[model samples]
Target: MRILYVTTSFPVYSETFLQREARALIKAGVEIEIISLHAGENSFEGYPVIRFNKGSLLKLLYLLPLAFFRRGGALSAIAREMNVRKPASFLNFAENLLGFGAAIVLEKRIRDYAPDIVHCVWASAPAAFGMMAEALTGVRFSTGAHAYDIFEHGGDWLLQEKLKRAALVHVSTDVAADRIRDLCDSGKVKRIRRGLNALPQAREPRETCPSLRIVCVARLVEKKGFPYQLEIYRRLKEAGIDFEAKIIGDGPMEEEIAAGIKGLGLDDRVALTGRLSEEEVLEELQWADLLFHTGVVAASGDRDGLPNVVPEAMASGAVVIGSPVSGVVEAVEDGVTGFVCAPWEPERWVERCVELQVDAELRRRLSKSAREWVEREFVADRNTGYLLECLEVVSG
Candidate 1:
């Protein structure tokens, strides 16, 4: 099957899941191409990436004749669909309006590729291309709805419209799938996790340590809840817990997080290591006894759809303490797979830390269960193979 992937950007660090998923699909003999809305690397991992300028009105005008000749039915359908949904702001309105016009150009491009499936990675503006492509070419297309598409500010502007048009929607978690199902009002959503390949072997038990070692492996973003992480560590310190803490990964909130650590007088106990390589991240995960995910629903309603590091930390034998936000609930089973704590309660995390610090047996049991769960659910070959099978069925 030939699958054309349309996305809003290319070569993003946070969206590495897309690269991995495409690689897996290609490895299984499915031909794939990427259409990036924003200019970036021309290709990734040998897949040809076609750049479609999001604001190139001149190109839209140039392709008008070709777009019209392809078909007006898809164009009109998309226009009506986009019209019904309310835009969040003037900026959103302009973006979608431009995307709607650009769809004609996208429709022309997709028709020429002649792929059996056109799938958009992010369901917002990118999905507009898929929606228009399917409408013009009569080739079935689909969209992927992650956390931002489903929960951020009531989802993308064209989400419902594209959901109604696509052949099926793909997601990574059951929780997100449930929400998408209600919006779609159908049984069209498929859940396929973008899992890891060649995970490092689970870490050996602690040999020597500066007391209990706690780690948070996430970008320094609002959704990752860096502020909450600092508070938890502060409470841990107040409880006289002699723990060493590290916050791996970096983002826009670096300065704020550093300030928080200093304000809470946690500089001596906690350290921030900016973005690390994939191997380095796994190294940190393996080195720690605890992984804290104090994820919260940010003001924008953006939250994690099961950050890859959660499963990575679990597989590395670090007992996870995740918040009850978004996909975190699906992975951490309160006390079985990993402990689930609310972002509001810093003391609860401290209590878990104290318990794990004192009870190696309890930590070992949770770690064993976490590893087992990850092995069953988040194995790359297994999940990707399942996704490929689903695509084959759909393309037929």
Candidate 2:
């Protein structure tokens, strides 16, 4: 069956998990195509990755013809479904409009693809685009709901309508699934776990240390809670706990993190090693004793829906120190698999670090459990097979 992914962009260096899952689905005999609104690689894993020319509001011209001349008030009906509060959530509204305009620009290409499933990679504008495709081509549409899609301020503009309209709504976390259900009385929401491309063998002799070796893999964003991570490191240092940290990845907060490093007098102990490739990340994971994912709910209501690094870190045999947000808790059972603490509590985080440092037996047991957990619940082929089965049922 043909499955087309609708998204804002494709082949992003940071979004390797999406690429991994798409590759798995293709290997399992499902035909896949992608239409991205922004420019990126032309293809991924030998499948077409069509890019659309997303012009400015002037490009809203492409939509006017479709919305006004034809489609029988489809745009108006979609508009009517929206309940976005102006000024408060204008960004969400603007994003959905941009998604719809991009859809209009690529409507012909989407129709020619003739997909059985127009699967949106997000619940916001990408889903809006998929819904528009459904209105135009009569194809079944599905959406993915994550933290940002159904979080604070009541999610997207047309989230409820899309939730009801979609044949399926894939959510990576129980938190997201529960929120989606509350927003829309639709049975389409499905809790689907994200999986690794292939399980990374936990390196032997898990960690070699004189000092506590910690690594963090995340974009420098508000939701990532880097400030809290820095606070924990500071407290650990002050408490005479010898440790070193390398924060992998970079973003808008690069300068801010740099300043934090200096301001906290952690310049010697902490290093912000910009972005690293997937291979390099694994290398870091192998070198570290724990992967600290300090995530929180940001001001924009954005949070992580189980960052891929958590499972990757776990599968690599490094114990995870993830916040108790979204599905991080699902894979990371506190004290059993790894440790969980509130991002705001730097003292608790420092204590967990100390506990891991002192207890080698506990570390070994948790390492084994983390790897086992990934093997049992996060194998790409197995999870993607289930996804394929669900899609096949929908295709029928």
lDDT of each: 0.79, 0.82
Error of 1 at 267 (Å): 1.3
Compared with the true structure, what per-residue lDDT tens digits does model 2 show for residues 1-396?
889887766889778877877888888988888777665788886677877665444756556675567876776687666644442377777668777777776667777878889888887778888888777767888888886777746677777788888888888778788777876654667777879877776664344455888999999988899989899999999999999899999899999999999999999999999999989998899888988998998887878888989989888878899999767998899988899999889999888888888888889888888888888988888888887788778767
How many angstroms is residue 105 displaced in model 2 relative to the true structure, after the best TM-score fit?
3.0
Tens digits of per-residue lDDT for model 1 on 163-244?
8777878899887887778778467889888787766697655634449888888888889887778888888899898999
Model 2 residue 367 CA deviation in Å: 0.8
Stretches of model 2 off by over 4 angstroms after superposition: 56-63, 66-69, 83-88, 205-208
TM-score of 2: 0.94
> What TM-score would you give candidate 1 relative to the actual structure?
0.93
Root-mean-square deviation of each candidate, in angstroms?
2.1, 2.1
**Clashes per candidate (backbone, < 3 Å):** 0, 0
Report the C-alpha displacement of residue 362, candidate 1, in angstroms. Answer: 1.2
lDDT value for model 1 = 0.79
Per-residue lDDT for 48 in model 1? Answer: 76
Model 2 — which ten-residue stretch has the worst lDDT? Answer: 79-88
